[model samples]
Target chain A: MSSLLNIIVVGLLLGGIYGLVSMGLNLIFGVIRIVNFAQGELVMLGMYGAYVCYLFIGLDPYLSIFIVVPALFLFGVIMQRFILQPLQNEPMMQIFATFGLLLLLQNVVLAVTRGQGYTAPSKLSEFVISVGPLNISVVRLVALVAVTAAALFLSWFVKNTMAGKAIRAVTQDRRAARLMGINVELAFMLTFGAGAALAGLAGTLLAPIYTMSPQIGGNFIMAAFAVVVLGGLGSVWGAYIGGFIIGLIEAFAGYYLDPALKTAIWFLVFIGVLIVKPGGLFGIAGAEEVGLREQN
Target chain B: MSKTDTMSGVTSTRDEGGAVPPGITTFNTELLRIAGIAVALLAVTWVYSGDPFILNIMAQTFLFAAVSLSWNIIGGFGGQFSLGHGVFFAIGAYTTANLYINWQISPWLALIPAAILAALVAVAVSWPTFRLRGPFFSIATIALNEVAFVLANYFGSITGGPRGLTIPFKAGLENMIFTSRFHSVLLMLGFLVVCLIVCAWVFRSRLGYYLQALHLDEDAARATGIRVLQVKLVGMAISAALTGIGGALFAMYLRFIDPPTLLSLPDIGVKFALIALIGGVGTLYGPLAGALLIVPLESQLRAGLSASVPGANLIVLGAILILFALFMKKGIVGLVMQLWDRFGRKSQ
Candidate 1:
């Protein structure tokens, strides 16, 4: 019973990390309808941004979030404006372009870092709380708290704000949204920037936990994709909840099955979900097909 | 004004007072074109016959060209942008390596089973995944590649695990291992010829038309009574089988197979699509044009920049991919066609 409890706790913490990583992806995917293969790279850049802050200015990883998030937002806007916006109509080109960005960012970092692993030290890295055979790291707890707060904030933002409503309108129908006089492109640029900013936030939080490598984005990318799919495309709450589902599955699968095979196992689950519910748990029934339709 | 079709096998164009439409060339003419291309490639091979470096590069170029041609069947013609073909390539490599290592089976004989297994796996996975459209399909395929990578690592007994499998050197035609680089070049050239023939045949066949129709508009194609799923499956199977054969040849040529070496997304999976895209997605000879340019350029970059900065080659390749996607969506073939059209019009 204690072990099961431990697994649940572990899963929830892991889910927090996954959820945080996937939030930005879900937003971009939901609104822009581009997979943004480089989102993980954006997260990686955020981690590095935190590292650079520590290296040059001696800023804490947590405080670096202020600098990193806005930087990534600007970066995202530029990328969407220059790279993705032109290829908006061509989904295939979008995939190629984003993948190109993935390779470029990853390798550029690799060349700069020379594959050396860096760890961004944080004051919160060593604290842990124990409750009746269940031990929780404070850093993880912080991530969980941050994700919940972010989710609530994002939900509220999307619900109440004019900008959020505009994003929703764009997601629903690009042509109709355009007819309503919404500058769909500006909305996309903002959404992408916000999404990138969220990814930056995830990176800052995650930096202290994992040894940073140029290829670390790869580790999160597939898992985040699983989270995004499980939760549903374009659904904020879905990504939050979906992250935990994947985390629990991964945690349970890792313990029960061969640890190495956990990724494969969840991939099977992802495929099954795709087969059974193509739109994901929280996604509209046919949103998966809707993404492929000529929105313009 | 009488003019011959320049964009033969690309798009069907009605010619004034002509019974046969331009771009719908007879099979014999395509065969002749293939023969001409083969001869041209052979001449290039003859020029670099003595240089081992060029021979190795040529061999790889042909191999990748063939694999990209296979990818074109589904990715280009059918409009399914798969990012998981590395799975099929790995399947082929491991299957052949296992057969040759364990059973003393000839690599040539192993090719048949490898192709069949790849096709089977392709059909099985794509059956469910075909329901996904656009980037969703790509995401699923990428997941499949990752799954294969994990499984390949775990199932060490068969795949030799992360340590990978290396075949012993035995110089013989039957063994498909040779000391001379020239022989490998010839073998790859032969493979390239076979892929070209198959692609050409498919390009002109009913299946090709069906694939193109669906590619243009899936719902409309379905409305017209085209069996969308079946057509995609058949195309994927054929593409996977050819990729499998290419993998077998790759394993034999390298005499080593590892999870990362075979299944790396950037190196194996995306490279095929990149070549196809850079050449011309749907054009018959695009893969060849792409391979001819990309393979040599990559090797040169690796030689020049890799020592100074690791992954510099990929940085350039990535930039090329982005630039191509942005400005040159139609790729080298498309550019050539536009120029050809201008010249033809000027002459008229």
Candidate 2:
């Protein structure tokens, strides 16, 4: 029973981080309809940002979130304006561009880091909180709390903000959105920025748990994709729920099976979900055809 | 053009084998041209026979070309845009390497079973993914590749796991290992020839027509009674089998296999796609063109740059890929063809 409880607690905490990372992918895919292959790279970059702040400036990683998130947001906007905008019409080429970004950033980071791993330093990094036979790491609890707050804040932002309404309008139909006098390109840039910021936040949140490396994004990128796919295409809430589901599955599988096979287990579920319902568990029906419908 | 007319046009074009598309010339001339290129390739190999480095590059060029050409079937001709072809490549390598290691079987015999299994796996993957279109399909293939990567590590006992598998070096005709670099390269060239032959054969067949049709538009292909699913499955099978064969050859050459080296993401998977993309997609010899340029450049970069600058080559490659995708969407073959059209032979 204790082990089960431990798994659930661990899974939920891990799920928070997963949700935080995957939300950006969801937002980008929802509005821009481009899978930011470099989102994982962005997360890696954010972790490095935190690493730098701690090592060079002596700022705690959690505290550095203020700087990293906005910095990443600006970087996202620049990427969208310069790189992604021209390739917007060519969906396939956008894949290549994002992949190019991924390669470029990952290699750049590798060169800078010299293929080494570093744990972002923080005083609270190892803090643990005990509650009646269940002891949870305080850092993980913080990650969970922060992400939940972010999700709620994002929901409210999308629901209330004029820019958020404009973004949603563009997602439904780009032509209509443009006709309605919304700055479609600006909306795309904003969405991309938001996605990047969310991914950056995920990086900082996960920094304590995972050792930082150039290859850190590689593991998350695929799992995040799986989460987005399993949760539903273009649904942030679905991604949040899907993240927990995968986290639980991974946790249980890691304990029950050989730890190495946990990713394999959830990916199987991802494949099954794709085969059974390509729309994802939380996605609207017929979302698969939307991408196809765009070109013609 | 009507769908039926397009189908028949592709069919008639195939039957003649002389109908030069936009990039090709007249039938007899094109055949002569191909023969000439083949002779030139052989001459280059023969001239540079003493240079072991050049010889090794040639061997790799042939092997990688074969793999990329196989990928072109599904990615270019069929428009699936798979980024996980390394799974099939790894499947082939593992099957051949394991058979040789565990049972002392010759790699020649092992290639057949490896390709067959890879084909079956391809069919399985295609069935589910064909339902999703565009980047979704590509994403699924990536996910599937990860699943295989993990499993390959998990079942490490049989697979030699992450520790990697090294084939014992022995020189013999049956073992397919040769003392002279020339013979090894020749073997790889022979495989390349087989891939080219199969590729050319399909280029003129019903399968080729259906594949091109599918590439243009899946729903339209289905409307035209092309049996979209069947064509995709068949295309994937052929591509996977050929890729598997290439993997077997690559394993024999390297004499070493590891989970990371075979199909671990960008290393092998993206390498094949990049080759095809750089050369030209949906063209018969594009993979060869890509492999010819990229494989040598990769080696030369390592020889020249990596000691001083670690990530320069990849940064250049990424930049080039982005530039290619944006400006030169059709790739190097298309550029060459456009140049040929402008200056090479105006009166053809």
Candidate 3:
């Protein structure tokens, strides 16, 4: 019973992080329709960016988030304009182009950093709160709160903001949006930047708990992918819910099964979900209908 | 006036109508392709025989090429970009290793069953994962590879775990051992030849058309009676089988199999996918071209940096992948084909 409770608690907390990371991926895939294979890499970069600031300037990683988020946003914008824009029309081209970008960025980080691993020095890592039999880490609780806040903010922004509407419009139908005088290209670029920035923020938040390394993103990317798929394609709520589900699964798996096989176990669940429900748990039903119908 | 003449600079005017250009016939195209293959075979064989070091490199290159060509069948030809090709490669290597060690089976005989098992696994993976498209498919593959690696590690007791298994060296045809590097080179060359021939046949057959159509537009292909699911399954099976064969050969060549070397992401599946991508995926000869350039370059780079720099190969390889992706999307073969076409036009 205690182990079950522990698993649920850790799972929910970790789910927030997964949700946080996957939200960006889902956002980008929803609006831009490009799977940023480098999404996790970008997260790794953000964590590294925070780590650099911490190492060089002695700034707290959580505080450095203020600086890292905007910088990553601009980096995302630059990548979108230069690398992703040209391949927008062809899905295969996008796959290869982003994959190329993944290879480039991952190697660059590995080369520059010499593949060093580091830990973030932050208050969150130290803070904790106890309630009866449940001893909760304050930092994780804070993360959960922050993630929920971010998800809510994103939902509100997409629902109310003019830019958000335009982004949504473009995602639904690029030709129709263009015909209606929407600058579809700008939306794509903006969405990509925003998505990347979101990933950066998640990385910053996560740095306190996790160690940073060039290969860190590889693990995160797979988990994020599973979360995104389980949540359903292009559904923000799905990402949030799916993230928690995976986190719980991982927490339990790590405790019961061998730690080495935790990832494999979760990935097996991911494959199962994909096989059972290709649309994902929260994905908008019939979203792919639009694209498939036009092709035929 | 003709599209072919305009593109190739061959004249189709009345002055030339009396005698058809020898180059324009279907027979000529086949002959040219055959001639190119023959020349490449001769050159590689010559290199294999002339220099012991070159023979070793040639053997490795052919092995890499064979893997890349196998990857291209599903990834490039069928348009399913799998980031986790290591699963099939690992399956092949491990199956052969277990069969040979535990069951006392010869590597030659082990390959057939290994490939069949790999194909079944590939099909099982496809049945579940093929429903995913775009990045989802790629990510699923990566996940699948991870699962395979973990499982390979989990069954450590049976698989020999991280310590790996060593095949006893018994030099004979039955043992699949070679006394000289030349023999290994010849063996690998045979594998390459078979893979290339299969690729070429697929490129010309009805399956090729179905694959191309699926790549272009899956829904449209399905609507046009392409049977996208059937074609994809077949492509995956073939890809896995070839990869399995490559793995079996790899085990035989190394005379040992460790989980890290055999099942690791870098050595088997990912390497093949990267090579295929770098060589002009989907093009018939692209994987061969990629293998020739990358394998030699990697070897040279490794030798050059062995003393001064430890991980220079990673940097160079990453740089080349980036450059290739950005500037040479079609790869070396694509560029060569373009240049050849231009020169052919000028001469005509």
TM-score of each: 0.96, 0.94, 0.91
Query: iRMS of every model, one decimal?
Result: 0.6, 1.3, 2.8
Residue-wise C-alpha lDDT for candidate 2, range B1-348, written one tens digit per residue:
111222232223333343345534333443444455455567677877898988997888778888898998888888788988989998999999989889989998998999998899999888988887888988988887887888888787767888988999988878877899999988887787677777766766789889999888788899999999999999999999999988888888899988888866766887888888888888876777777777777778867876776776776677877888778877767776676556655654
Order the candidates by TM-score, highest first.
1, 2, 3
TM-score of the A chain in candidate 2?
0.96
lDDT per residue (tens digit) for residues B1-348 in model 1: 000121232222212212443357866677777777777677778878899988988899899999999999999999999989999999999999999999999999999999999999999999999999989999999999999999999899999999999999998999999999999999999999999999989999999999999999999999999999999999999999999999999999999899999999999998999999998998887887788778888988999998899899999999999999999999977876676566645664
Candidate 2 C-alpha error for residue A83, in Å: 1.8
Candidate 2 DockQ category? medium
lDDT of 1 by residue, A64-152 (tens): 99999999999999999999999888999999999999999999999999999999999989888989899999888888998999999
User: TM-score of candidate 2 restricted to chain B?
Assistant: 0.90
DockQ comparison, 2 vs 3, better candidate: 2
Number of the top-ranking candidate, with lDDT as the measure: 1
Model 3 / residue B97 / CA error / Å: 1.0
Candidate 2 residues A171-208, lDDT tens each? Answer: 77788888889998899999999999988998887777
With candidate 2 superimposed using the best TM-score fit, by how many Å does residue B115's alpha carbon deviate from the native?
1.5
Lowest lDDT 10-mer window, candidate 3 chain A?
A287-296
- True-vs-predicted CA distance for residue A42, candidate 3, Å: 1.0
I-RMSD for candidate 3: 2.8
Question: In model 1 chain B, where is the ten-residue run with the lowest total lDDT?
Answer: B1-10
Model 3 Cα displacement at B254 (Å)?
2.2
How far residue B72's Cα lies from its native spot in candidate 3, in Å, is 1.7
